[model samples]
Target: MNPTTLKLCLMAVLSLVGIGLYGLMICRNLIKMVIVLQILVKAAALGLILAGQMSSQINLGQSLGITVIVADTIVAVVGMALAVQVQRRLGTLDVDALSSLRG
Candidate 1:
């Protein structure tokens, strides 16, 4: 790949990571937080692929990206399930509300 293309891809990865972090920090809803986490994981997968390409190991990068995708999907599913339960029992999806719960 050309240096220019590599730089662009790197910029994209950085942008995604920045946006994901910003969203995670600012969002109070559990579902939105889950979405932000997905964005962060995608950025990580992109970074891994970019590194593999730079190192001339594209296949390894692709395999790692696929693995990340699979793991993230499972995480998202579980997160959504928890969100649903929280909404059902607590009547809200706010993180602050969850903090009031006692064991």
Candidate 2:
């Protein structure tokens, strides 16, 4: 990749990370939090892909990438299940209402 192209890729990945971080910090809904978490993971994966592509070797560290993908999938599944349970039990997805445990 040309220098400019590589720089652009890096910037894009950084921007994605920043956006994900911002959303994670600002969001109060549980589902939005899960989505933001996924966005952060996807940003990391995007950065990895960009770096791999720039190296011209095209090697994605398949073992690690696959492991990460599998783990992410598992995480999303479990998160969805938990979110559903939380919504059912709490009647809302807002994170601020979680003080019942203090009782």
Candidate 3:
């Protein structure tokens, strides 16, 4: 695409990843952590889309993006499952509370 558009796209990806990282480092809620992880995944997908637009191998980039999306979905499902279990066992969804979880 246009050079300006490409720069904007890259900026958007950077901002998205930055937000996710900030959330991950600062948030105490397990659910919020999961949501931030998804945000990072979305940023990755956006980067892949931009890569496809910039390079000659459009199909390759698209396939990689799709793969990332599928992997993210699987991870989200598993993460949510574990979060649910944690909530049930600990009666709280806070990251600080997870420290008390023991086998």
Worst 10 residues of 3 by lDDT: 94-103
- Spell out the clash pairs found in candidate 2: none
Q: Which lDDT tens digits does candidate 3 get at residues 2-38?
A: 8999899999999999999999999998888998999
Clashing pairs in 1: none
Model 1 lDDT per residue over 24-81, tens place: 9899999999999999999999999999999999999999999999999999999999
Please report the candidate that would top lDDT against the real structure. 1
Q: What is the TM-score of each candidate against the true structure?
A: 0.91, 0.84, 0.92
| Per-residue alpha-carbon lDDT of candidate 2 for residues 2-77, written as tens digits (9 for 90 to 100) | 8998888789889989999999889999888889888888777777777667765457645455667788878988
Off by over 4 Å in 1: 101-103
Ranking by TM-score: 3, 1, 2
Better candidate by lDDT, 1 or 2 = 1
Q: Point out where model 3 deviates above 4 Å.
A: 101-103
| lDDT of predicted model 2 | 0.81
